[model samples]
Target: MTSQEEIKVVLLACGSFNPITNMHLRMFELARDHLEDSGKYRVVKGIISPVGDRYEKEGLIDASHRLKMARLAIQNSDWITVDEWECQQPEWVETAQVVRHHYEELISSENNNDDVDTVRVTPQLKLLCGADVLESFGVPNLWKPEDIEEIVGRYGVACITRCGGNPEKVINQSDVLYKHSKNIHVIREWVTNEVSATHMRRSLRRRQSVRYLLPDAVVNYIEENDLYSEESEQKNADVILAPQRYTCTN
Candidate 1:
């Protein structure tokens, strides 16, 4: 594999991004640096696909807000872009399908290009996630085995190591993960960050400052919209912000 030319890869991160944090954006750089520094692959793109509103997860804001925040968060970025396809869907879409959709979109665009002389190597699309998401695959009935196989075995995954999370151990325990272990790139974070959307919401609910944890634009947007407050919760009383099964610190 080392003898072959550098492979072009796009990292796709699908999440609830109820409110994207700095750590969420940091994952892309960390994964890109690791993949590029290895001299094996050139990461051409980074995508953040916020889950649809139908995904009734705790502390989740409206899909419009998440999508807007995502776009604002990556406004300064050169390669990373927010894809609203997932968030626009009428129902919740799984992560595996999200990866496949982007993979096909990239391929379709390349095929339609008029430049015939340009080399058309199919870029590999891999799901980018944190260790907390990786660990959830082990929970009983949480994920289907076939979906896991399709995501890990087919598209591949670039997992960033989170604090107190052992990605390697989780990979070894799961048969599906172990089978495609080579595809799973576990990136280590030298300077750990514990910022997460859940913790950020808690702070916001209390009317505390979230200046540094999120982008300035995002901070201002939250303040302007009055999101994640007790009144907002009361307004949408039907939507319960239940305790999340996974302690996502990403």
Candidate 2:
């Protein structure tokens, strides 16, 4: 097993993170625990990949707010850290390119110092996703097959199964994914909890309690900002379903 400083695993848990929730935390914990159990790394690190530029995507709050919520939600968890690099970059970056760049940066940083005793580390990178995103892979536009192979060849990949879905379906479809990458892993524990950001936003608009669905800090922040209130929901209904619009184009 690699030492803690030398061991690096990037959890590409990127999303709107409109409000971070316990389910998100559970995903991180499970990934960390699984990697440790495999005896590959001393510590697992988490990186939040929040979308930055607002082109066609809808319902995206500013990156700063999302970054803050991510930081606050993971404040107590030592393994988790927010990665704002993607957000800071110029607009309309492809997902595969982002993944490649991130790994390159990681490698460059490890070799930055010349001290022989410094102990350089080559960390494994994994892109974390729910079953929904995996299912979307069948279509070419979301992520192309060649690009998928490139990502796996460059860095490790991991996924957590969504409730009431077979994760193996996507895995089996991508023969290239398994062929190129030796370190691909899927979470054995299925998350039975059904949590969705869309549902949470709608509930908030209806004045429903989101206590268990979101972290305490996130819930408080939402209430303080009056985000997703009835008026806000009405104004942003079109934006909320922007991804769905893309599906029609495909």
Candidate 3:
């Protein structure tokens, strides 16, 4: 590995983003702030890769809608952008593949550089996730062991603890997570963010207000499109927003 100053950091967020929440956007800022504060890594890019329509998750809207809403969620952030590659997939793309895909793009772009003498180091790809996503990792058959190794070993994670979820407990308990603990950066929120897409959707189902929970642009888009009008069928029982499950798109 190159020196921290030489290496770059790219944050990739893979999710359904059924309706991106404020904390979704805040994760990038908080991770970036943590990296900068450490004087170790420089954040070069932040990409929100919404799961495709084929992800087949409950309450998941159309890929087109999710992509646009994700774009709107990060329109103002210069370093942050939305990538449709994952969403365009015919089936759900695993998290490891998503990270590798972006890393490959970086290498390809660097290869195209005109300067022959200049050597470019690939930017480190790290998944920006909430504690909920981390929690799901250990679930039986949720993620492949090899994928877990790549996700936490090859590409690391920056997890934001929501509602006082203790990420370290998960990290310290799991062998894979514990082995790659150095790669994981845990950001603890003194004031836990209780917001999530499921909560927003449930609120919308009941005709409740969701303002300030998500981006203003997203709020306007959701209203104009009249999304989440139909009551949730709760197809994925594990996906429901609860105190224990903080909603991770998976």
Per-residue lDDT for 191-232 in model 2, tens only?
478787778888887889999788888888888877776554
The TM-score values for the models, in the order shown, are 0.91, 0.84, 0.88
Off by over 4 Å in 2: 1-8, 234-250
Tens-digit lDDT string for candidate 3 (1-250): 3364545899988887988989888989999988767778888899898887656677777889888898898888899999999877775666777888998988898888888877667778899988878887888666777888888898899998866478889988889999999999998777667887888998888889899899999999988988886644354435633212422224
How many pairs collide in each candidate, listed in order?
A: 0, 0, 0
Model 2, 33: alpha-carbon shift in Å? Answer: 0.8
| Candidates' C-alpha lDDT | 0.85, 0.69, 0.81
Supply the global lDDT for candidate 2: 0.69
lDDT of each residue in 152-244, candidate 1, tens digit only: 999899999966778889999999999999999999987978898878988999989999999999999999998887654454346542212
- Among the numbered candidates, top lDDT falls to 1
| RMSD to the hidden true structure, all candidates | 3.7, 3.5, 4.4
Better of 1 and 3 by TM-score: 1
Query: Which of the two, 2 or 3, has more TM-score?
Result: 3
Error of 3 at 165 (Å): 2.4
> How high a TM-score does candidate 2 get?
0.84
TM-score-superior candidate, 1 or 2: 1
